[model samples]
Target: MPKFAANLSMMFNEVPFPQRFAAAAAAGFKGVEFLFPYDHTPAEVAGWLRENQLENALFNMPPGDWAAGERGIAALPGREEEFRAGVARAIEYAQALGTKRLHMMAGLVPAGADADSYRATYLANLRFAARECGLHGISVLLEPINGRDMPGYFLQTQAQAHALREECGEPNVKVQMDFYHAQIMEGDLAMKFKRWFSDIGHVQIASVPARNEPDDGEVNYPYLFRLLDEQGYDGWIGCEYRPRGRTEDGLAWLAAYNQ
Candidate 1:
């Protein structure tokens, strides 16, 4: 069976951030993931995971100036120093949380920006992150967010991500495949998963167009779940979707899957 991890950032909003650990555990989740855990100290976050007996599935490295509309700095020129500092801080949290996967967001592209410059910076930054993370036995991840949801985002396609990964030539650097974005940008979900199975570090799901529970998605998650089991994907499948109602109440699909 494929292991599922609750995305604390999106799910279990009825409770406080710290309390969501227990909420996820009580809802039958053995692992959990979130966008960023920088709001709380590593010790505090680790304590909650220990208390709830939940494994930390994955989390993102700090995206630069989130409130000011910056998505990430990994691809932005002149932010190399800031990006490296973020990587170190992320490793600190990963060690405390016992997390093995870290997603690195490629920052948004400026209007009339030089693609070559951004690509060069992104590859260099990814190589740096891969080296830093490899020493600690952690894998760095690159995700392709659809343009519709995140306009001007530096990364936007699976092919592009894979090409960049190949160019970086780092074994520990892998792709974070979110099915929601995949379905939007590239509809051949099953084939794509199979094609890139070797380089995929993490998986996530949500309904296409609506970005809700996977139960009603355009893509058939049930079949995909079976495929993951058959393919022997021994990785956590992150539930990174917003609930239609109460997070727990909207988990009928999870209950059904477990049954």
Candidate 2:
């Protein structure tokens, strides 16, 4: 069976963060991922994970003004210092929390910003971050968001993420294959999975059309899960979906799967 992790940010919004950790453990998940744990002290987060016997599968680096339309500026010109500081802080937090994967949010580009300049800046920042993370034994992942969900985001396709990884030429940096965004930006989920499996460091999922539970929408998850098994993907598949109803109530499909 694929190792499963609950995306506490999306899956257990109805519960408090610490409580979400406990709930995920009770739900039979081996690991958990969250947006950011910066609000709480790293020691506190680490304690919670150890108490629950759950792994921190992934977490985001600081996203400066991501909600205010500033989007990611990790690769934006003149923001190199800010990006480096963010990566350093993220590495510190990951080390404290015993996290192995850090998702680097490549911020949004300003209108008419030179694409070449932004790409160059991004590559430089990635090289530095990857080298630093390598020393700490942590892998940094780049995620591509869907334009429909997050307009003006800098990276929005697997192809772009793959290219950036190639350009960076760093073994510690890889793509975070979010199935929800990939399904929206490009179809052929299984084939894409096969093609980019080597470059991928982590995977997240939610059903299409509704962004709800895996069984609530168009994506055939059973088939997809089977495909993942066939491909020998041993990484955590995060349950990163919003609950249309009570969180536990929405998880009925998982019980059915178990049965």
- Top candidate, metric TM-score: 1
Candidate 2 per-residue lDDT, tens place, 1-259, comes to: 6677899988777778878889888877779999989889889999989999999999998888756766666778898888889888998899998999999888877788899898888889889889989999999899999989887788999999998899889998989998889999997889999998887899888989789888857778888888888888888888888989888887777875454
The top-ranked prediction according to lDDT is: 1
Residue ranges of candidate 1 with Cα displaced over 4 Å: none
Model 1 Cα lDDT, one tens digit per residue, 73-133: 9999999999999999999999999999999999999989999999999999999999999
The TM-score between candidate 2 and the true structure equals 0.96
Candidate 2 error regions (>4 Å): 256-259
Q: Give the TM-score of candidate 1.
A: 0.99
Query: Cα lDDT of all candidates, in order?
Result: 0.95, 0.87
lDDT value, residue 137 of candidate 2: 97
